[model samples]
Target: MLTPPEKPVHWNVDDVVVTEPDVIRRAIGAAAIGNITEWYDFGVYAYFEPTIKKVFFSGLGDTVGTVATFGLFAVAFLVRPFGGMFFGPLADRIGRNKVLAITMIMMAGGTFVIGCIPSRASIGIGAPLLLLVARLLQGFSTGGEYGNAMTFIAEYAPDRKRGFLGSWLEFGTFTGYLLGAVLVTVADAVLTEHQLLTWGWRIPFFVALPLGLVGVYLRSKLADTPAYAALEKESEKREKDKAGKDIRTLLRIWPFLLVCMGLVIVWNVTNYMLTSYMPTYVSDTVPNAQGGGVSSTTSQVLQIIVMAVALCTIPFLGRLSDRVGRKPIAWTGVGLLIVLAFPMVLLIQAGSVIGVFLGLLLMGLALICFSSTMPSTLPALFPTEVRGAGLSVSFNVAVSLFAGTTSVAVGGLVGLTGDLNWPAYYLIAAGIVGAVALWFLQEPNGRRMWGSAPAAGSQDEAREVVEHQDREAVPA
Candidate 1:
């Protein structure tokens, strides 16, 4: 006899809770503040690359000093995986907020200390050594800061709006960079060469301490996320488990780990290329028959305009991802990277103010596609139990190994080959990696985060989620 069709199973509406809008806003602010602080340091460092080389590596030739300056930048990334391995599971065990607080202090402190260190003229080799130590500390702390921030915001947001909310984390990122660019530009414009080299370059690094302090204060006011709290309670009700189990469980989800890393590589290579390396590339690395590439003031101004455009557009694209699936938007970005990488580089190579601006703008546009979507997309890859550890480990490893070293790798290659188009070639390679990874990514838009109960913004939305789930459950 034929079996009757099985009835569709219904999810309980009680599982969905109305999250307060105020709570979400607070969470977004707390999470984003750390990002602003972290990237602010990067912005200052990148924009001040020329000054930093003169300050710390003045003993070396210009090319070697440029490479060494980038080497110090890359040094911070090298230790990031270690920081992630320690903090990711710790955050999973204790709470994201506590770990984030600690990292904020370290990152801000590291940046502040760099400002205080004496230059090469004052202390000889000790200056670069101290700078290396500071960068390492910043790198270690950052390994923890960003992943947890992503988790903190992602877990707090309602499923339907996570993309829009998560985009604010990157909004903080661009704000930090823009602030750095503007400061560096203003300093370069106003200060005499001797004044800038002697005293002015240190000013932007000092700003990080205040930014970090404000971030710490904001984060301290909020509690752990509702999703993490739920998971903690569930673990308490069951037998208490060792934190090592979370790491082991993360290992079991190797496919998620691989996909997460792949996407991160694509996202961050583009990110570092635009935010960290582009300043140096435009102003220093690009060859000009007249001797210098773009003028420093002009490069900084062009970058500021690109960042301003990105900052304004990110939230809109993030909201768009919520309406359409994230994959479509990501595919557009990946496609642009693959197709336009060479053309954009050619524009920058043309050496006009407008050409450079348009080139940088194209690069910025591609970078934002991943930025707007990835914060929300990545945290969804693992179940709630391992979200912090999984996201942190995967994100940091990819960034440290591949993305974080973009400047050094690209610069070294260009120095060796004398090819200005290496940046374009690198971007194309990153885009190809993104396409492969995008193929594996499940459409995370509008779905509840893995291993978490459905969340809604209001009671009516809760009811709608249940009704929608029921409709989805019905067989065709």
Candidate 2:
């Protein structure tokens, strides 16, 4: 059995009891809603890439405009690491709840502004430039949103069910992407392609505003996590102790960060491939291949159904991880990707809707293990004080440098190699990296959180302070 703290730590703040199922559900809802808003905007943008290219970058010509449009899409990722660095510490310092509120506003505002921007014909170079600015703002907000939401929701969870609850955060992301697909697919069915290009594309972006508002209200009303409150009290008592929350201290644990980065590389690469890039890949490659061609609308609807299946399956995998542990569950997904990528890609290449659906479903199933386990797994690697900072920095850096480039990189690789299987190859390589990292990981399923103990090499005085609190406090 895993070890627990010898005694419970005392703090000035009231314990935020999360054992109640109602509290757990609320925490899950608060964390998940913001993710829905954030990814919905991204989904809308990605699904409408062709329209965006025409409306915003028409001057570049169809070929160059396509590349430039996706290039701008990728550019937003360049700023994510910086966003993580900025927001991570703020969450660690103030509290996760308030930071969530701030990120929601930023994300919703940027997305709304994108919906309002004029076309290239109306604004010349300013259209794409405005689009770029909005993307960067949304990217910045999202960089911090995932790590902090994971941290907040994880901290609120009962240790045994953390994986399941954390998975809901990812489920929110899936739902958002699904909603984006539905928005575009439905809009296409209802409006003429010309009308979609003219104004219908903006409808999904407008939805972010209200969803973000609701997320903000839900998060703002909740009490701070018990873990963060304890850290706050501890920091107030000894301002110089840098063990749990300090960046310098966090940097010293580079090994852990690398592990986190490896996992994120796998997560983001596969994630973007399925969620962001698949439609484009299908639209471009599959139609010309074996299974017969599909319309853009058919591709979008198929993806939505696949994602809906993924959404239902994720919580079960997450709950299973809670029972069996994170590593096994994570490795299961990675293993399947390595084994199934080629077959899945081949199916997708077949061009028919059934082929696309089957291919996406297989890939989506392979991705769920990584998605569900990661939210719980990443935060537990750092102490509560530095959980936000640690997970955010590592995750965003990996995402920006590697995962964000998956679509463009894979596209280029396919162009260079004349092999449509390059995306599967890319995923296989990422899965190998993740598997290696997983081999070195210590299972953290039931680890004690921050404020449960003193620093590893703390002075006698600091030890006394920690032990004193433990002895005095009454356990729940």
Candidate 3:
């Protein structure tokens, strides 16, 4: 029941109000914590790919084992769309915080359980089956977790600084990734290969429980976002007048769904490429004239360095987007992917440590462009009433079908043709799709969220916004 002033015809800025800066900080922290938990699981899995293949798919030979490992990685994505379809509308009806808390518990529980599952040697066929169940649970929960988290932060952030603030969500993303990467690297360096395959991998998975608990604690401290609070009030009135289902409303806005999916496709394609596929690609897949690709440890170290760079750069680019607008920054990412995809691939193929680092760094740079901007940009594609559902479904569906499967598709294609450049080809195709989506996107910088009143960090800023609106209302 937080309420702002009534809207004015010529100046919606009448509804502009200052949200306490501390509350906004708490909200961002709460929303971002879930991302950290979720991606931490992914980071652990990606970095442990070779060991996982040995433990779970030992019967399959090297090539098939690699594909099967990546396929399990893709399994979580397969269930994400279902999670979105179920939880998205549920969030719209109940509340974002409630849905988020539920998804978080399930996500953390799934990851923790993966650590406890017995090796294939212990359980035969049942081992991989248990892993599959855990992955499905993780995927289902993630479908709900990410989109709601994005909507939650976007709604809570002030209009003028949304881009800068929203980027913190991904900051948490790389933080989790780095944490997992560092642990795996440490474990690899210290433990023998036999010890790592037997117990070390489980260590990272067990960490998810603690991370998820922290996220839950943070989220429980905050109320649902102000935008969601207001949407609840509006929904009550709509219920009295007999409104349609959220799904039906979402269907009516199909164009936004397509655009959302397209943007997600481009962004996550690059995301999984760098974070998920690159380690395997650099260490196992790429051909080296000297013999094998870079060592497993070298690949992990290179990827960690690249992720560190991206993590540090994301906030600055996000702040920059607030000033320059999201489209230009996203377009720049798309342009880089198209123009540099092959070159980056070639650099990695060179097989030297410096060559691989530069290649990964290039991809990381392209990725942060989308990372910094999309959190703020994608949430703007739908109105508040359906925002959670719209974003969850569209984002998960796109990710499940295209982005999450990057490693699998690229790996399968490479195995089929023995081509080392398929990752580059995949990136180029994604960039082309991104360019098309960008063509249709409306710039969202400095605008209030679609169905929420303007928000400001301070009373003075609110007053300034109203005055600025008044001046604009007086005609050029």
Best by TM-score: 1
TM-scores, all candidates, are: 0.95, 0.88, 0.94
Q: Candidate 3 on 35-141: residue-level lDDT in tens?
A: 99998988999999989999999989989999999999998899999999988877766667878999999999999999999999999999999999999999999
Clashing pairs in 3: none
User: Would you list the clashing residue pairs of candidate 1?
Assistant: none
Model 1 score (lDDT): 0.87
| Model 1 ranges with Cα > 4 A deviation | 1-10, 224-239, 288-292, 471-476
Count of steric clashes across candidates, in order: 0, 1, 0
What ranges in model 3 sit over 4 Å off? 1-8, 12-14, 224-243, 287-292, 470-476
What is the RMSD, in Å, between candidate 2 and the native fold over all Cα? 6.1
Model 2: runs farther than 4 Å from truth?
1-19, 224-245, 288-292, 450-476
Cα lDDT listed for each candidate: 0.87, 0.79, 0.87
lDDT of 1 by residue, 1-476 (tens): 11112354566789785688988899899888898889889899999999999999997998899999999999999999999988887777777888999999999999999999999999898999999999999999999999989998888898899999999999999999888888888999999989999999999999999998998898877755564466456544432566458867877778888888989998999999988898988887775423546787888999999999999999999999999979998998899899999999888888789999999999999999999999999998887777888999999999999999999999899888888889899999999998988998878888777766777898888889998985433221
CA lDDT, candidate 1, residue 241: 63
